[model samples]
Target: MKDPVLSHVRGTPNLLLGNYDLTALGYTVDEYFVAGTAVSYRPVGELGVDGHWDVVPAERADYLTRAVTVVPADGARFNGTVVVEWLNVSGGLDAPAVWLMAHRELLRAGYAYVGVSAQRVGIEGGAALVGDLSLKTLDPQRYAPLTHPGDAFAFDLFSQLGAVVRHRGDELLGDLRPERILAVGESQSAMFLTTYLNAVAPLAEIYDGYLVHSRFGPAAPLDGRSILDPDTVASLPCPRFRDDLRTPVLAVITETDLVGGVLPGYCTAGQPDEKFLRVWEIPGAAHADNYTIQGAFLDSGRAPIEDLAQAFRPTDTLMGRRLDRFLNFAPQHHYVLHAAIARLDDWVRTGRPAPAAARIALTDDESPTIATDSHGIARDGVRTPWVDTPLAATSGLNTESDRMSKLFGSGELFDTAHLHRRYPGGRTEYLTEFTTALDRTIAAGFLTSADRQEILELTAITAEWRFDPGAFHQSGSVR
Candidate 1:
């Protein structure tokens, strides 16, 4: 494979929800356009239901795409790990969803982060996640030269970017030598990453590991069809990761992803964990929770406790419109994901495997629903203080009246009576129980100790918030 040419881009990068100051965190953010010919893939034989996709290079097209990279300002601070995020266009724009979720860990630990605009929706523009924002439309003069040959070629485009970062790190990272490269994507990008892991990773041999977060059952087809093409999507088959895997894959699933929302759920494709694969099903988590929509962009690792407190507040609005219920503000999804990233890095670099986790308990119904405990929190899966030491009921299912709000999930704090009954001793008793659960969660490897103080601090804030009558603004629910 030929190397792609990289030229520094001189303008404001139009990254959706990319609001953090990398410079303040001892990192520098830059944009570059990588130009080269990328090859699209086709199934070698029939596209089977099993994720063991056999594909070969089918068509070649010349393309130019942009990538935003955040690296340590002082090269000596580089931690030798580069996380390449397949920027999601589910919202009709390039969104660093995973980056938003795990930036605190990445920045604090000195890992470099890169967001690639690989999909057609990011470049050409279509649909609308948070308005019809795209590279071309955001800043015409700056991104005018960028071109993407549809999503059929997206797999190759992503692979090529990984190759550049792996083989030619100095070109992009200066003195930073990348020891391990992990490919991560969420939601729409996760679906595409699932296809990439099954098909392209075998041939390209680019990434050291893969993190497929919040993916639906069916992957984006190898052919040029996207999520927008319902006719083509309806005809495709759901796939499970091939049993014989070479690289390590950490699949993280939330309640909204396991069960159906607007699209098919991943429950159909669930498979047993192999030596190289680990599936973590999280209960009481949503596809896009409060941290995803609000906190991720603002929490830059500086004020960890203060920023995390923001996610605890309940709200019914999304983007702009008011929703039927409060958005799922459970912080477990974001905190657990931080640990997942750390575990993947260790697994790739030291040959250690991440501990296996229980799947979220579900009903036996054909269209399964997550089984919940008395508090309405999902049962089993990765246990956390939020669920075990509960003060409120949180769920990944919410109203489907609004298309975008469906993923935000729902939450309702326990009424004053229920709260009093659950913890008669009040704030002190709640903290004691919450702390015990937090310790156990960390020991079990679901939460990292590096984030322990922050978690405890956030919990303390939650205790104060819930105890304060002024903060309990919801009337009907408080009775």
Candidate 2:
């Protein structure tokens, strides 16, 4: 468990200082490889399955592939290793910025990381292939069409991309036989991870975890929006992909990514009780901005990098004094990654998910609502100022609209004795009324949590035979 020392590049140590500057950053180069000729391909736009666009492959060629090993400057203790595979964002084989970030993070976290260029677009001889596709063109419509099924370019590229990583990862980590191996990808790389998992999961026993962030896919006609829609879920050809996945997955979604909309929807569609589907919804962050902004790719804040840097320091190192110098970036993203890694690590060591926090009851109300406490009694502004009632007190109610409205408004005694009997006590009667109103509100899709609570509480208080200020329920209080 000693902090791993960053190893130096073997031969041509001077070249490392001149080119990539690994030693300057405290990272030791473990190994490096220059892959052979790049693969040449053509993008032929044609209609494919389900009327979707696909790239009809025209040709193939060899290209240079570069693989590098990055280990921490001051190696931290880690029980596992992670392989960072970045999908070609520009459909080129060049090194990606995100890959660099992943390299830095993995090294700092005390895990050895390897980055491989999947295609020839960014590598030597990539110019010929990139020139064929004209990736320099920035038209969204053109890009969208090229990504469809009829075009075999994207599909073929991603398939090969996954193959290359699986081969390289197996070769590099053969002796280490690390306890856990994770494949991390972002954006297009995220989609590549999905493709890889579909094809390689059963065969690749070495891989224990998959982390897909900001996934993008083909667009669906129904939404005509991003392809990350529920409808497009059918587009993925992998059979029972979720049910069959043996490895745990961490699917991260950013609020602003329209292309990632299907992630949450897909997670919800699958069996949530399964340990494999770990979903995290990050708020107020754009796709990959959490890492880019902190890494100085954007002009927002420097705190995230500094925070990560501090985590890299030795235990006895006085990181507290310099903490103030770094900007204060929100830790939610970092924590999300940390949490996923921790869960994956735990599962690697013990054949089960790590202990999870109690499932909090999600509220439809927008105003930060919480459920009843351990006693199962929550007070809303209705029964007693501190109403004592079960968390789902409003579960039972009739479906009729008018009766429901009256019950939710000022408490009213229905002429039918049967109704009162069915509702039981005054609180029950009010809750039934509120539930009905809530049902209607849900249908209309306009009611906020505060509005629903107000309606329910008003109905309850109005029905009380004896009123007392102290007896009124307070909103959000769990009795």
Compute each candidate's TM-score over C-alphas. Answer: 0.96, 0.45
Instruction: Give candidate 2 regions above 4 Å deviation.
Output: 1-26, 34-64, 72-80, 88-105, 124-177, 204-206, 217-240, 258-273, 294-331, 354-479
CA error at residue 96 for candidate 2, angstroms? 4.5
Candidate 1 clash pair list: 91-129
User: Which candidate leads the pack in TM-score?
Assistant: 1
Cα lDDT of model 1 by residue, 63-160, tens digit: 99998998999988888899999998888888898988888789888899989988988888986545678888878888899998888889999998
Error (Å) of candidate 2 at residue 29 is 3.2
lDDT of 2: 0.37
Residue 12 of model 2, lDDT score: 36
lDDT of each: 0.86, 0.37
How far is 346's C-alpha from truth in model 2 (Å)?
3.0
